[model samples]
Target: MIRPVAVIGAGPFGLSTAAHIKASGIPVRVFGDPMVSWRDHMPAGMLLKSTPAASSIDAPRRGHTLADYCAAAGISRLAGVEDIVPVGTFISYGEWFQRELVPGLERVRVVSVDHRSAGGFEVELESGESFTARAVVVATGLSGLSHLPPELAAAAADGPAPTGPVSHSCQHHDLSRFAGQELIVVGAGQSALETAALAAEAGARVRVVARRRVGFGAPPWRQPRLRPGSPFGRAWSLWALSHYPQPYRYLPARTRHYLVRRVLGPLGAWWLRDRFEGKVRVEEIDRVVGAEALDGAPVLTVRTRAGATGRLVADHVIAATGYRVDIAAMGFLSHGLRTRLAVSRGTPNLGPGYVSSVPGLYFTGLPAAASYGPVMRFVCGTEFASPRLTRHLVAAHG
Candidate 1:
């Protein structure tokens, strides 16, 4: 009997890949709470940066798009690039997709995955159940990869918590708890800007500190029409990056890494511009040099572009600095297996079909960004990743 393929996550990539694999008549086991990250890590009233047209999860069959979910659930239809998708609506869509297509998904945690001496992998779940799989796909998106700057890590010594003196933006699900408090949000990205806007709307006095000028994407109506549209945005470069990710792995390592980080860099959604401007204070600084807890409050020492230094104190400091993909941080992989895998800049070095150096071991989502370009970092990339990965699994193992 062929052992089932083990899918280690339940987000867009994992669910999409599982649906495709199962559609090909391959036995598979998917493990994780459906849309757990979008439901738990993000704030209650938050909106996705991706436009409605780019927010659907990839499925092997038709009628499983976000539009289908909205129509069936009686929610307002979302079709345009200008339409903003609420996190709640997207989560519900993901759950609906799971129910309709990937119904056998296991809502349990996979504790560890280790390679067997003979072949294949041994997967152990939190429930003390163990199983063997012909292959393993690690689609755990940004779960344990929150990147907190070293300057602010000391202030958050208590670790990331919603109510702590200093915390990462991913720690909060409800910004209402911070009402009436003073907040210092660090970063110019969507997460930082949107978190500041939400906190201010919740009655908190909010200020955003960034290393450079904050930027907002132009409204859909204002965008130039000459270039083709891709999930990242409308640009020839973005179009190529999103449509031809397979060639991305062939590029030099430095170029791939630089493009992944530089493309789609820190910028907020156009709709958020009105809510953020004038409502939240913005300060451009050289860098955050230090942070400390003083008198039960967080104080940040920052340098200016002009070489001047100053300190700012706030009731709480949020490090909305985003995530870094480090395979080592995925504690589910045993030390022996991790050291055997080839990685570049903390990301797995993936080949065709998103397979890593170790055979039968694959990664997708944020972790695949370095090898597959910035497209893998968004929900829309699953359209490219899922079908190709399914084909590889069927041809190799089936």
Candidate 2:
């Protein structure tokens, strides 16, 4: 009898890992819809921050790059940083990769994961089916992990679902729904900036509130130059971290945590700056100190950089504050199983090969960022994580 490895997502990291495992001749089962988050969560008309070459799902074999997708699709292939890749194109590329390499991927959701008495994991599906696997990779993307600030989170906790005035940016797909309404978007990151632009474009009265000033990414150079570095950023620290991910695992936890939080802190793409210049109102150096529901709308008390306090009322509040990895928040894990995994703060403390404290259970993607480095947060990280994890799985389980 052969025990297969179970992968819990079909996004870039999940697909990349699954393709590598399949190529390694190991039995693997991939669950979830391909590009589900990108397709469903993000508003239309968004562009990827990474360049075309870097925005690739690592194929066990060659020729599955984003450039290849553009060529095969009869679109002019992107050559340098000048060409921007849209989110829609990337979603199409992911689905294409799944079709070409990772076949028979189950689109069903894993409802629960419990440790078997003997060994391995018993995974129950939403379709009323169950199976045991030698290993399980919890690579589910940003779903169930959207982070809202304490004030907004408290207000959201009282709502039935995402219909509440206070909600995370992840809960929205189309900004057009907020047309002709007043909306306050929190955070200066790409998600916040872009969503604010989209909401304004969709006819919403929008204001962006952030604790710190905004920083936009540099635009592509008029003349393409070959500077060897990581796609993560132009900084040497980012370059080093992207190139040598394994060494990051050996760094002190404090250093690792600092890099994870600061290295990739909030910034919008250069192209988006023009959109927010005149259209969206930006309240920089201001933080949402408190939130309350008044007359069925969200009223936010904000503190300015100068220590002055003010209030702003909006029909909706979008918390683009980003995600925090909390192992206990994973609803699919049984209480007993969740308690068994080790964690530092909300993040799982992963060992080499991306294995968690619990044997044979693994974590990747954003959740792996704290342990593996900042690169784990992006699509390019899959290039490093997939092959290494595949080798580990093959040697240990195959």
RMSD to truth, every model: 0.9, 1.8
Per-prediction TM-score: 0.99, 0.96
lDDT of 2 by residue, 145-198 (tens): 887778776556574234787988877887888999999899989999999999
Clashing pairs in 1: none
Q: Which stretches of candidate 1 lie over 4 Å from their true place?
A: none
lDDT of 1 at 174: 88
- Give the range of the ten consecutive residues with the poorest summed lDDT in model 2: 221-230
Off by over 4 Å in 2: 157-162, 222-228
Q: After superposition, how far is residue 376 of candidate 1 from its true place, in Å?
A: 0.6
